[model samples]
Target chain A: MKVIEPHIHMIARTTHDYERMARMHTVACCEPAFWAGYDRTSARAFHDYFTHISQFEPKRAAQYHIQHYCWICINPKEANDLSLSREVISFIPEFLAAPTALGIGEIGLNLNTKNEMTIFEEQVELAVKYDQLIWIHTPHLKDKLKGTKMMLDYLKGHGKIKPERICFDHCEEHTIKMIRDAGFWAAMTIYPVTKNSPARVVDAIEIYGIDHMLVDASGDWGPSDPGTLHDAIFEMRKRGHKEPVIETVFYNNPCYFLGQCEKFRLTPDRPREEAWA
Target chain B: MNSFNKQAALTPPKNASELLDIYFLDIRSALLESAAALDRIERAAGGKDILDDPRIQDLKRACNIIMDGKNNRSEQILLLLSHPLE
Candidate 1:
C-alpha cells in the first residue's frame, strides 16, 4: 500500500532514511519547517533552511521516486524572537510560490507565549492572503492541551480561517477530540522515544476512528525513526483493520489535506466519504 | 464523520494463542532488549540505590500496565508515561 508521510523534517535526515521510506512504499513526504535541533541565528539562516527544503530536498527525494513537498514559515520554537521572525516571515512569500512549497506550516505556539501567538496569527494571515493550506505543530507534553486549545480558539474565532484547510499535528488522546470536533485535521506522530509510540497511535485510531486523521513518523535529528510510521501500519494490520481503513488514515487522509495545494500530486484511491464508510 | 459517529473498521484480531504463534520471537526480542538495558543501568549505578528513581518507577508502572490484560494497554501505559493531563 502507498503511504503519505505528511509531517517530517527531512533536512535533518540522511539519504538512507529516504531510501528506507521509499522501500516501505512511502510515495510522498511533506517536510514542514522545524527546529534544527538548535535555534538558528538569523533570518538569513531560515532563508537558507527554507531554500534547502524547497529547492534542494525535492531533487533529493526524486532520486528515490518519492515526491518531496515543504511548507514555509518561522517555526513556533523560534517564534519568540520577534525581530528575527519578522525577517523570516518577510521572505516566506517568495518560497510559498515554489512548486514543492505547500503552504505555511508547522506554525503554532512553542511555549504558548504571547509572542508565539502573535507570530502565529501573523502567519495565519499570510496563509489566508496566499490561499495556502496550513500545517500546525502543537506544543509538546504538558503544554500541549492548552497550546492546542489556544490555537483552536483563535482559529475558530478568526472568521476567515477554514478548519478543513488546516491540520494540527502531534495530537494525543487528550487533544485529538477537540481538534477533530473543531473540524480540523488531527495528526498523530509516532516516535521511537519521547512521544507517541506506534501502539499508542493505533489506540487513538481505534478510539477516535479515522475521519480527518493523519499519522506521521516525524523523523528528525532527535531520537526518532521514520519506521515508526510503518510500525503503526503494521500495528493496524495485526489488529485486523481492513486495508481500506489503513489506507484512509495513512494515505488518503494526507492526500485530502495536502492535496489542497495543487503542488501535491497524489490522489486518494477512493473518495474520502467512501473510505470513512 | 467525527469520532462520535465513526469507529475503526476492524474485525477481531487473532486470539492471543494465535498471536503468540506469530509474534513470539518479536516479543522475546523486545523483552531481551529491555532486560539488557536494565542490566546496564544497574551495573552503571555502582550499587547505589536508584530503584526509587522516577524514571525507573515509570518503567515499573508501564510494566504493570502491560500485565493488566486490558485492551487499551497502550493508551494506559502512554498516559502513565506522558506529561499531558488526563
Candidate 2:
C-alpha cells in the first residue's frame, strides 16, 4: 500500500516521525514551506532554512528510502512581519529550481487578519505567475469560515488561476463543499484537535467523494500524529469505505495532484526501494 | 512596488518564513501602495458618501485582495517567526 502524504513539514518534525512514516510505506511526502521553530530575520536566514527543507531533507529522506518534495511559500500566519517575508520570498527561486521542489504551497489565511489576507493574495498571484500549483492552508480560528471564503473568492477573481491548479487545505465541515464546488483541489489535515481526525476524514470522503481530494497529518509544532495518513487509510477501511477508495485518497489522489507539479514524479512502473523491503 | 511584484513575492516569502522578514515587509509596501491608490480614489472621487460607486470601487477591490493577506498563513508564520515568548 503506497501512500502519499501530500502535505507535511518534516523540518519541525523529529527523526522518530521519519522512522514511523517510513515504516508505513509512505511512497512520497510533500512539506509545505513554513517557518521552522527558529526565527529568521534576514534573507541569509531564509537561505539556510530553504536549503534545510528543500535540499537537506530530501537527501535525508533518501536515506530512509522515501521520496521527499517541498512547497515554497510563507504561511498565512506570518504575513504581518513584512520585512523578513520579503527576503524569504526572494529566496524561493533557488528552491523552485530544485528537483524535489513542488510549488508554492500551504499558502492561505490563518487568523483572517489584514496581514494574512495580503500575503495570501500575493502568494496566489506568485503561483499563477510561475504557472505553479498551490497547496493552501486554511485557518484554525472561527475565522476559518471567513478565511476559506476569502481564499476561494480571491483565487476565482485572480483571472489567471484555476481552482483545479490550487489545493485548499485544512478544510472543515463548514467549508469543504464550498471548496470542492468552487472547482479547486480539496484537502484536509488530520491532526488531533484541529481539522479532521481520521474518522472525520473518512466521513468527508463519504460526502465529498475521492476525486481531487487528499488528506494528511500536516502536523508541525503542536501535538500531532505524523502517522495520521496511515491512521485515516486504515480507519476508513475499517469504517467500510471501499478498500479501493481508501487507497485512492492515500495513494492515487496525491500522486495525481503531485503530477501536476512538474517537479514531483510518482512512477507506477518501477519498484521503489521500499517495495523491496 | 508594483501590484504584479507584490503578487510575485508571496510564494517565496511563505516558503521560508522565519528568515524572510524582508519579504513580508516588502509585501506590506506593495499592499499599502494599493491601499494608497484606493485612498487617493476615495478622496478624488469623493468620500465614503459616493464610495459605493463602481469606478473607485475597482481600485478598492484590488486593495482589498492584498489586504486580505494580513489575515493569512504568512501572518501566523510571523507569530512563529517572531521573538519567542521567553
lDDT of 2 by residue, A64-161 (tens): 78899988877666677776676667667667888888888777876777877887777777777778888888877456777777778877777777
Place model 2 in a CAPRI quality band. incorrect
Report the lDDT tens digits of candidate 1 across residue range A106-159: 899888899999999999999999999999999886677778888998999999
All DockQ scores: 0.26, 0.01
Q: Identify the runs in model 2 with alpha carbons over 4 angstroms from their true place.
A: A268-277, B1-86
Candidate 1, clashing residue pairs? none
Q: lDDT tens digits, residues B20-61, model 1?
A: 786789879988999898888888846347777888989888
Q: Score residue A71 of candidate 1 by CA lDDT.
A: 91
Candidate 1 is scored at a TM of 0.84
User: What's the TM-score of every candidate structure?
Assistant: 0.84, 0.72
Query: Which stretches of candidate 1 lie above 4 Å from their native place?
Result: B1-12, B15-86
